[model samples]
Target: MKNAMPRTLDRLLASFLQCGTWAACALIGAGLFVGTKVLTAGVALFILLPVLRVVLMLAVFARRRDYLYVTIAATVLAVIAAGCVIGIRLGPLAG
Candidate 1:
């Protein structure tokens, strides 16, 4: 367990780039939900990314039952949520 944080952090950092992957998936899902507009798609994606991340994180934690991993994953999800909120608020105006 002592090495879990470092291992988790490393895994997270590697997949941090995959945030874009989640974002893209989200945008596509959102577009499907709200109709196919660039702004709406962007907004949908912004919201979806964090949700997907949270769901995936929860699943991973559930499977492993690692408290440290869960905490780190939750932190990442929170950061994603903050970014999504800011982006959603600004997205329409930017359009």
Candidate 2:
């Protein structure tokens, strides 16, 4: 049972990533014919993939009552959030 749980979570995470990637690719490809909005959506999804993965890891750790990992994952998420907030505040001009 213990071993099975990790495998299941791994599979779930893998599938989620795969689906998200494919969806993003499809949107980008369609956008080539449709417009910039769809392409932007795809780009956003690509950027968000890592964040979503961390969120998934946080959820799994929390569910398993793994405080150490939960805290680590939470910290990573906070950092990512902070970076995004800073980037937004700075705006394109900052770059």
lDDT of 1: 0.70
Candidate 2 is scored at a TM of: 0.86
lDDT of 1 by residue, 21-72 (tens): 6666677676787677954766656556557656676666766777777788
Looking at candidate 2, the ten consecutive residues that score lowest on lDDT are 1-10
lDDT of 2 by residue, 1-95 (tens): 77897898899899989999999999999999999999999999998998999999999989999899999999999999998899998898777
Which pairs clash in the backbone of model 1? 27-45
lDDT of each: 0.70, 0.93
| Candidate 1 stretches greater than 4 Å from native | 1-54, 92-95
lDDT of 2: 0.93
